[model samples]
Target: MVDYSTQLIDGNGEFNVTGLDNFMKAVKLRELGLSYAVVAIMGPQSSGKSTLLNHLFHTRFREMDAFKGRSQTTKGIWIAKAVGVEPCTIVMDLEGTDGRERGEDDTTFEKQSALFALAVSDIVLINMWCHDIGREHAANKPLLKTVFQVLTLQVFVLTPLEHLEPVLREDIQKIWDTVSKPQAHKDTPLSEFFNARYNLYATIKQANWDASKVREKLRRDIEAHASSVRSAKLSEIVASFEKKLGQALAAPVESLLEASEKDTWSSIRRLLKRETDVGISEFSSALTGFELDQATFDKMVQNLRDYARSVVEKKCREEAGKVLIRMKDRFSTIFNHDTDSMPRVWTGAEDIRAITKDARSASLKLLSVMAATRLDEKPDKIENVLFSSLMDGTVALPSSQNRGIGDSADPLASSSWEEVPPENTLITPVQCKSLWRQFKAETEYTVTQAISAQEAHKRNNNWLPPPWAIMAMVVLGFNEFMLLLKNPLYLMALFVIYLLAKALWVQMDIAGEFHHGPLAGLLSLSSRFLPTVMNLLRKLAEEAQGNPAPEAPRPPQPLGSHNFKGQTQQPNTVSSSVPVSSVSSNISSTESGDEYSSPQLTHRRVSNVEQAESS
Candidate 1:
């Protein structure tokens, strides 16, 4: 049902997709759980849904075989087990919806088949053209909507109560927004509720305001009122803020609030994302065509994401529970809204860093504390983990040395130091996978952090190339050649050579493959042109020691068998040249009492994690 394949190659009589090795594998999936994943072959009478299924599933339930009958063959859900041993597959060919009107009560199984298929399958592979994504009420649209409605309901039932809270709120808010809340019904007498609504407006209306103005106002106010604000209580600040908001709204005065900020789509997205986080994942039919207003959506999404994250972390190992308790205590103090922690200079950098750092720490601390509590241990150990994780993109001093990171060449420069728990035994492949995901996320996060600061770092992430990146690559590569020759004028000449090489190669392979596809794809990649380009970059990088290391390419990895689009594959050999100091000599990837490094940390960490359960 869920097609893991990317393409369906067309041929003389039918698609030549059967030539693919995966076609064999797919046939086996047809019967994996003994519950045949119902795949509905749907399209206009001639968009080739049936033809596609017949070829894909190897079903002979009467298609336009050219050698068979001329009339329409299937009437209801005609299913046949996949021919090959790919997997247990059920191919359900539904009557085409776009066919000419047969009779007044003539029932096509499009709607019914969709409902039935969704209930039973592990996946539902909707066969359609790439062009059908946005079409309104296209032949497959109703089927998709019905299936979605059904799935959404199932999701709500299976999920927990806290998970459903945000979804419920989103529905209510969406309805109120679309219907305008009847002008707040002349304001509630509850101060907490009123202020909450007021803050929501502040968040919405000021969403697009320039930071500079706000910074200036904050600075002036802070300097003028620092002495007077020393003894201000938490409740007092909230009250003051509410009073200011009420005056601003009643007077319609133009302050720092940005007029151009409020947008409807963001509101909808906020609500949608929040609902998804809370696991509601579907809207009540009563609010189907409703439009959202103001800041309703953003707040909802933010709240739900935060809550879902909280719930999931609480479900981690017992040790994580204790960590959450400590974090809650810390956050309660921070919630006092005291301005002392705020920076003196309102540089956007400080504000962004402080906010993000606090948020990240709070989240990790919560998870760690929860784990600790659940495991029945002191929450203090979580502090070490929290601090270590915060150093994700930065260097850490030796616990014994007590020196700050980047104390010399780059006191501020981030260090590439990561190590698994010392002497922790890796036990299972499943544990290995989990740790690997954490490592991969950390690596990608480092890259993101570098980019955020206009810094450079090495990471294996490679996906869609931005046009600017292509131009920058050419410029940087050509410059290396120009520098060697000491001639700036030769820059354009070198760039031309690069472009010409690329153009000639594109015409040679990609052009031929446009309609024929996959045929020329491998050639283009394996061609000398690509190799030549790669060689040129390697030379350039070698020439400049300052150049950032390219992400380790994963083209030929053995571990990555799934080959999903945009997924980075696992490589056969991993070679990293991290500083030896970065390796925790005290922390071994094994509990064998034999501390030594292998070619690299491969089977050792996994083995250690597995041992922890026994230890």
Candidate 2:
């Protein structure tokens, strides 16, 4: 058989991880889990602590020989499995304390081994010589002091019945009285301070190494130990499964939400059920070792499923909290770009009304998906209700219209849906209505800007005047045209003026400035027109006066080397001023109802507009 013992901690206080792993595997300790018990023995150097463990639990801890004289035997802490002990008790043989070899000043390892034993062991056996019991400076006194300083534990004193005189009992009581107690246990009695006293030597000698009584005692001790630990183990198991469920559901649910497909909730339900089923299967398998009854097992499994469902619900609610942001993003994605994901030019040929309806419909669908939990697969008319009520404006009749006979009541007038449970409702009917209003109000400006852009595109492309205006101009200017043709100098002057006007028009982006409206365009033109003309006049006058005019800056090279005739080129210009009225109107409309507006919403809208303009 494989040796099931190893030095757990070496003399230098380092844990032997590899040796411990091998020891655990040899002992099959993992199969015991939390059902096992730990029993540790500690005392003065060469005082037979290892011998006592070997006798009581049939362990193979090395013992000191009397012929070799008194010295340290066990170094650090050595652990071994009890061969015949019931419920799988593991025994620890701690290094002997107060040896002349280590010197008087060094008790660090002694105190450390004592504390480690008390911390991990369910039963600690302190071995001391019978003669040293009543001494003022007993070898185990300092060890007891260290144990007492950390935590209050039930101490057990084991001895042979023949040596257990009344005086020895008094010495044990006196030792307990001398050890300093924390304030919380200062008034406790000796009987309460220590576990029961036992004649361990007699018990071992009477049983003749059969260990039948020791096995029974160990079984009881392990049962008591398991009782205290079972609840915590159960909690740990549930907590681990809860964390796994959350991790499994997080990514898939987030992707489903972003896609916002028709069957998104159904997909999430399936995912949750699958993950929870896997968790419950593993959980039940783990609990099988515990041998729990049917009711308790069923309760734990149900709790796991409930926790998994709660995880999905929590994810839905968290995504619902960001519903407005998601809706805005969806609207932007559909409305700002075309089929190929290229930025739209808002050409007049595209139908703005149809595009706006399609974008709003998409956004509303997202809101509908998030409004409730549909894990039961029961289909509800949430999307249709929202479309008819909010998008189509067919749910809420006007007050006057409602006053008419046989007028139907508002469908979206309630706070909750008809079939949805309160626990499952992420967003209520009223909240959806309010959100739709805000979404429409916020998105209206994009549509308006698109319409304005289409108008501007049409206006900019029209190079020819109407036919009637052309006729009138030709008829009215016939005499002037003839006169100009008769004089070569006049015709040349007219050509120069035409060239100057065309150059100014191209350089200033005059057509772009006039696209806003008549009054605003006139104001914009008046602001820049006079200064441009005066600068041109000044430059010409200086050149005529024979003063060296500043060298004209060279134009940038065109992308193509060949220059084609009959095509008019327009200079690129970035407009610094955006029309303020459109911006103000958009902001004011968003703020018309304070109930729907927040500082964050306003700031976000402003930032989005700035980003759009920049792009």
Candidate 3:
């Protein structure tokens, strides 16, 4: 028996969102947030729409008084907060349609009120007497048809046992009997028509009403309502969960990274799985408060697991890089220092072989740490994929080629070694030194870039107070001692210092400093020499252009030799005095010198004889 203030719209049908706002405030809708759900009822005049809502939700919405003779007691639309629902529920009582008071001619208010309720409510109850279901002009039918056009409407039967539990579905024959009438082939009997429509409707309706499907949809709707009510809260919860997962993973990965290279691989696989399980377990526990259905819960669990897996994979690689850094540190330490950590003064007597062996061993061990990236699969497979990614830009040199001390090898020397060494075999100290140097350079560069980016971001965001502010406070503050007047020299010195500092800060290029380093001086020298180098190259190119490339010699040609350079004619040794008939007949033998005087005349005689044969 909770008291709820009922909100009403007057009979004129004039309402704005402000009315809804006032009603929401009265119901404490803002306080309920996403935990609130709306239930609306629509039915004919005097059909117990408000009465049903009052009983179901423990709301005291105004109902019609039979003694007073009903004349749309609930005019327009009415709303009240539910008193006894699990979630914060708002019950909407829409104006009844086809009222005797309003008459059938004007059902505009009824339609408008129904639309308004349907728009705002999570679930709508279409209240109708069992007898009125088949009637064409029933108030519920018109509203249902109207709602069907706009909403994804589903039918559910509420029983005395529970609120939303579905009743046993009627048999096809029983459904047909209720919706149909027997007629002697009256176009197609009304029963047949109803049965055809019923069959199609049953497919969609049954799917929605299935126990599992109903539960899933309800869970989704609940989540949707909760999201709308408290979107910020849910976002905060998810962010908190992600933060916890990251924190949980930090320790194991850090511990694995701190380990000696020889022990890193096996330990990483174990630690990665353990930390991933922790993250997923924590996320799952966090979701329990939402009270999701089994399907949704399982789906969320899988999604979290996948997220954990990706995070684990990335973290494993990063931590592995740390191990490589450690190995490089060891190699550098051994190569550059004596047993006492003192800088080495290289001498002829020093056992270079022993020192080099130790350095090589350390580098190899570091590489081994990188090889163990996968938790459940083979190490070699993970090694291949990881090395492929790390060495994506690297081009391997031929096995026969050995790089000099100062010369650069492949970015990852590991990429150049196609064959994995046998357990007993070892790579040379020179190779190890080259590889370690490259790896160290790459890791240091990445770290420097990351630090620079973070610094830039901080500068942009200005998380801390600027340095000038402190100076300004000291110089400009109201001091009882009158510090500024008493110390003119100090003020002038401060001004000079500020101007100098501003000039330097404005001109500073931190990123350029990192990228260029000691190379800046050398770069400036190169820039000065660049024009001289280009002019020298141009002069050399001009001098080299004096000798043109010779043409290729052509092959020897046969006589008549149109293929020769100048198309030379053979000597006309035969006499032209012979008859044209003889010259034409003997043209083939003329090359054997049967004396056709002119070669041109003999050719013309042959051409004339050939043209006559064609005609």
Candidate 4:
């Protein structure tokens, strides 16, 4: 067992982030005793998982911090105690995997995080990215597969409420006094628990299993315990208990613990199937209670109880949810926003905005306040707290009606922020598989270059010092530094030097020693013109980047190609309307043999996909 020392490094450290930030995080975790479980963020680079965690968990993990022209930013496991979280609830932000664009051969961190999560985590939350739910080879797939495989090794039978039945788990409490029937409801124990035990003993007997010495020693002890059994139910199980089946039955645990995950996946699948409708095999599994063995059934029943009771804190939530939501609604009403969905919560009343451009920031603020209030800790910075307030309903519209703002308007009146609904989180998915593929190709090229460099260097028996690269980097510094000196002010300094030379010539009685000579005048003229020329060149370059090499226009596509028009295609629909970005992209990119090239947007919005396929 790895000793519980407060020093295991997380992914942030893997990326070479150190110093005071690391020290403070370590200190906080150690003090709170919250560094036990590991929770990883799994997704492609720039997926906003880090941003979301940082925003939600109050972490300082930087999002997409790669310098211009750098490879992947996140390199390894970064551990930190989730801020505003309970003790022993550590969040291990893992380096996202399957960044095939980054490099293919090195998946050391991915493998490492999988093993770490399996070994240490009691609850490994696979954060369902609002996007990337169905894409094959999506960051979640490999990560989930690893989690599943390794989880096989560390199996313990746990019956959590969410495992057995989901419908019950989702039920809102009718009343507080009314018992939501204790969450762990495994009353009728599976008869198979006893039957399976009998079969195990029979298998052992058939194998001629024996620990003769242990049996002889325990004969009297067994008899004494057996006599104390009052009920026939447990007695039979106790008598038939054999040790070997523990290994066989461990993988599925309840088959019920999977109920939640499976159900969650299925729900996600259907939702994906409907929206982008990548139209994979329509074959889907239907849950049939009768097909499950009694042991499987009983375990399911038990798991739901545990999950609902503790993890979900179903009862306590019922009480808190009502009060908090009401306050949230008031804020929403004032802002003309929807109460149920804004983004997050605000710290106090003053941090709110009448109408703001920064929705993401607003949401973070809402979350900050809610989280802070929970722990009774003051929020650190109001800047991010703006975003958290989105969730708290403290964020709303400027008006009671659309296109309007001001007083007596519903705090959540106009409802600019569409609530996420009582279902899946809403986000814009950049289905840029093609873009990613292009990026992957570039990375692959770079990797090949790197490999060749390594081989050539090795063959030449050449050595490069760590500082040598630092020195080599100075070449870039030289180019940039030279460019800076070429600025007009520095050019003027050179002109001054020429004037000083002219003065010497005049003092020495040299011929034609004028300070205002044609040469000096021309130099001044060039200096004045150079800046404009440089500015023009920079602008041209920027515009070129902006318009990139006018993508080689392609032949028109067949009808259903994503190139076709969406709902707003009709001339009549153009009442000064813009095409819904998601639909427009789907229609637009379909024809381009290279489609997945969406600019990543981190802002959370009401997903039109869910609404589009609202079956």
Candidates arranged by TM-score, highest first: 2, 3, 4, 1
CA lDDT of 320 in candidate 1?
26
lDDT by residue (480-572, candidate 4, tens digit) is: 668758797867877877765554333222222222454764554444344333433443464556532332222222122232222222222
TM-score (C-alpha, index-matched) for candidate 1: 0.21
Instruction: Please give the lDDT score at residue 426 for candidate 3.
Output: 30
* Residue 505 displacement (Å), model 2: 8.8
CA deviation > 4 Å runs, candidate 1: 1-38, 65-71, 104-108, 127-140, 152-615
Q: Candidate 3's residue-wise lDDT over 129-188, tens digit each?
A: 444544556625555555544433333332223211222223223333343233764344
Best of the two (1, 2) by TM-score: 2
**After superposing candidate 4, which stretches have Cα over 4 Å from the reference?**
1-38, 65-71, 100-102, 128-131, 152-615
Against the correct fold, how does model 4 do in TM-score?
0.22
- What digit string (tens of lDDT, one per residue) describes model 2 on residues 319-399? 999999999999999999888999998876899888888999999999999999898888787887888888777774454
Model 2 stretches astray by more than 4 angstroms:
1-122, 127-138, 141-222, 285-289, 395-408, 465-615
Question: Which 10 residues in a row give candidate 3 its minimum summed lDDT?
Answer: 195-204
Give the distance in Å from residue 97's predicted Cα in candidate 2 to where it truly belongs.
Answer: 8.9
Counting clashing residue pairs in each candidate, in order, gives: 48, 0, 7, 70
- Per-model TM-score on C-alpha atoms: 0.21, 0.55, 0.36, 0.22
CA lDDT for candidate 4: 0.37
Which has the higher TM-score value, candidate number 3 or candidate number 4? 3
